[model samples]
Target: MSTPPPALATPLSGPRFQQTSADLYAQMRRTHGPVAPVLLDADVPAWLVLGYREVQYVVSNPEIFGRDSRRWNAWDRVPPDWPLLPLLAYQPTMMFAEGAEHRRRAAALDEALGAVDQFELGARAQQVADRLVDAFAGRGEADLITEYADGIPLPVVARMIGVPDAETADLVSDVYRTHAAGEGANEAYARVRDKVRRMVESKRRAPGPDVTSRLLAHPAALADEEITEDLLHLMNAGQLPTAYWIGNTLRLMLTDDRFAMTLAGGRRSVGQALNEVLWEDTPTQNFPGRFAVHDLRLGGRQIRQGDLLILGLAAANQDPLVRPVPQASTGNQAYLSFSHGEHRCPYAAQEIAKVIAEAAIEVLLDRLPDVGLAVPAGTLAWRPSPLFRGLAALPVRFTPAW
Candidate 1:
C-alpha cells in the first residue's frame, strides 16, 4: 500500500475552498508544484493535479492511472461514515469499470444517449423552462437558484430516463440534498439510487423510448444491477452539472457588464457566458479520480502504487500556462470541464446538457426581459463543498407579467 500523504499536505475541504478555489489552487501550485499533496475528509491524503498538462496526462494514460476506486490504499483508514464514500465506492457502473467491461458499459450508454432526439429534448426543455418561469412570473421576485435553475434540468433528465412525472418532484429534492454534501447527504444518495432501481424495475415491465429503456434493450446485455447503478450515475452526472451550468451562466449574464448588455435577446452572448462558466466556475470543480496502478512519477511527484489522485479540473482550466489570458476563452472549447480520456462525459450527453442549458436561459430571457439580481452580488454565497461549486441562492427580481 502507498504511504499516507505528507504532513504538510493541504486539506481539500474548508470555507477557503467555497468561493476562492482559484486562489487556493494558485497557493498550492506555489507550494507543492503541479501535483500537490492534499488531504480529503478525515485527513485522508491524495494528490491534487493542478497543472493543465499533468491533469491531461493522468486522464489520457488510464493504463497507468486506472479508474477503479477499489485500488485505493486508504480504504484501511476510511471509516464507514465517511461523507465521500458514496462517490468513491466501487460499483457495477462504467465510472468504476475498466478494460472490456468499461467499453461495454460506455458503448451502451453512448448508443442510448445518442439516440435521444435533440430537437425534441430542446422543446421539452423550453416547456419545462416556461412552466418554471410561470410559477414566479407573477411574483416578480424569486431565488433563481431554488425556483428555476434547480427545477429545470432534473425533470427533463428524469423523464428522459422514463421516471414518471408524479415522482420527479421528490427526486429533485433528493438529488439536491445528495449534492449538498451536508446533513443527510448519504441518506439522500441512497434514496436517489433506490428511486433509480425502482425505475429500472418498472422499465423491465414496460419499456419506453428513454435512455434507461434503451440501455435495458441494448445488445451489450448489461445486467439489471449494472443498468440501475449506471443510471444513478447518469442522473446525478447529467442533472447537477447542467443545472449549475445554467445557474452560473445566468449569474455571469446578470452581474458582468460585458454580458449584461447582451441580455436583451443576444444569443451570441448567452453562448459565450455558458462557455465562460465552464472555464472560470465549472460546476464540478474537482473529481475523486484516477488511482495509480503502480509506482511512477507525475509532475515530479513520486506516486506509489494504489495512490489516489484527485483531478483538479477547475485548477487545470485556470492554469496560467494554458490560460495566460482568461479573456481569450471566449470561444475556445479546450477547457477540461467535461473532463478527458476514455471516461470523460459522452459527447451526446454534453450536447444534451448544452441543449437544456441554452433553452433554459433563452426562455428565461424571453419571459423576463429585465431580470436582474435582487440582492447585492457580494451578498451571494456559494455552497460549501470542494467537490462541487454552485451558488447557495441566486435571488433576483424582474417586472411581473401574467
Candidate 2:
C-alpha cells in the first residue's frame, strides 16, 4: 500500500489554481492530501479543500467553519485590494449568514423565488433564446458566449423580479465582471447592487407577482437593507454562473462529439445534458467564503481561528475519493455545483437555473442544427475569476436562417 502524503507546509496558490486541469487536481491531492493551504491573489493564506468528503465536512459543519467574515482572523491582515476580495468578502445575505440567521434568510429568499411560476420561467427562457437567435441567425456566425449565453439569463431574471428588461439589460451586461480581478470590479458590483435595490424599492411601492414583491410580502419581514443585500446576491446567483452553465453546456454539445451525437440521436434529454455539465464542468465552480471559527485540526491540517476556508467545488467534483458518473444525471447532489448545507442554493433557484439553461440551450440547438465553433475549443479563453468558471467567448457559425 502507498503512504499518505505529508500536508503542504506553506500556503501556496501554485499554478494549478489558475487552470481547469486534471494536473491541478492531481497536484492538490498529492501535495497536500485532501485539504491544503493556498494563497489568494495577494498571498492571503487560506485553506483550499479539494477532497469530496473533506469539502462536505467543512460545509456541513458550519459551526466549526463559519461563513461570517466578522469571524475572520482578528488581525484584519487581509486587505481590500486582495484580488479575490471581490469574490471572497462577506456580504449580509444568506450566503454569509450562520445558524438560525441562515435558516431565516434562506427561507425568505426561497419564498420570494417560489412565487415564480416554473412554466412561465421556462417559457420566458425559450422566448429569450428565440430573440437572441433571431438577432444573429441571419449572420451565419457569432460569439455564442457574449451574444447568446450571456444574453439569456439577464432578461429572464429581470422579468422574474419585476425589473423591466430594458432597464436591466445594459446594466447586467457587466454583472460577470463584478467578481473579476482588476479595474472596475468594485464599481461594477456597486452598480448592479444599486440597480437591483431600485427594483426592490419598485416592488415595495407597486408590488407585483414577481420575486422582489414576494420577498417584501414574506413573513421574515426583512429590512430593506437586508433585502437589498439578498437581492444583490440573487442577481449574482441568477446571472453569472447560470449564464456560464448555458455556455459551458453548449460548448459540450457543440464540441464534444459524444454530446453532439447524443443530441442528434434525441436519445438524451437536454436536462440530462445540463446535468452532465453540472457534474463535469460545473459553472458555479469554487465558492463560499467560509472561515474557521477556532483553532482546529481538519483533514490532517491544523487550521487556525479566522483562517479563510474555501470549498473547492470544481476540485471536489473531480475528487478521487468519489466516483462521479457524469453519464448518470438524475439526483446527482453528490456534486457541490450549487453547494450544499443550510446555505445551499434555494430549490426554487435550482429549478429556474436548470429550466432556464435547458430551455435556452434547447431552443438554440433545435433552431440551428448545423451550428459549430468558429475557433477551436482549446483556443477559447476562460475568464480568470476564481469564483465562476466561464468562457471569454464562444465564436460559432450557423447556417444562416436568411
Among the numbered candidates, top lDDT falls to: 1
lDDT of 2 by residue, 294-344 (tens): 888888888777777778888788876676453454346667888888777
Question: In model 1, which regions exceed 4 Å deviation?
Answer: none
lDDT score at residue 113, model 1, on the 0-100 scale: 95
**Residue 4 miss distance in model 2 (angstroms):** 25
Tell me how candidate 2 scores on lDDT: 0.77
**Model 2 Cα RMSD, Å?**
4.1
Best by TM-score: 1
Q: State the lDDT at 50 in candidate 1.
A: 94
Clashes of each: 0, 0
lDDT of each: 0.90, 0.77
Per-residue C-alpha lDDT of model 1 across residues 1-402, encoded as one tens digit per residue: 559678689987777877788899999998888999998888888999999999999999989999999999889878777778778888878999998889999999999999999999999999999999999899999989889999999899988989999988988888877776667878998998998999899999999999999999999999999999998998888888999999999999999999999887768788889999999989989998899998999988999889999999999998989888876865789999999999999999999999999999999999999999998998888887768888989999899999
TM-scores for every predicted model = 0.98, 0.92
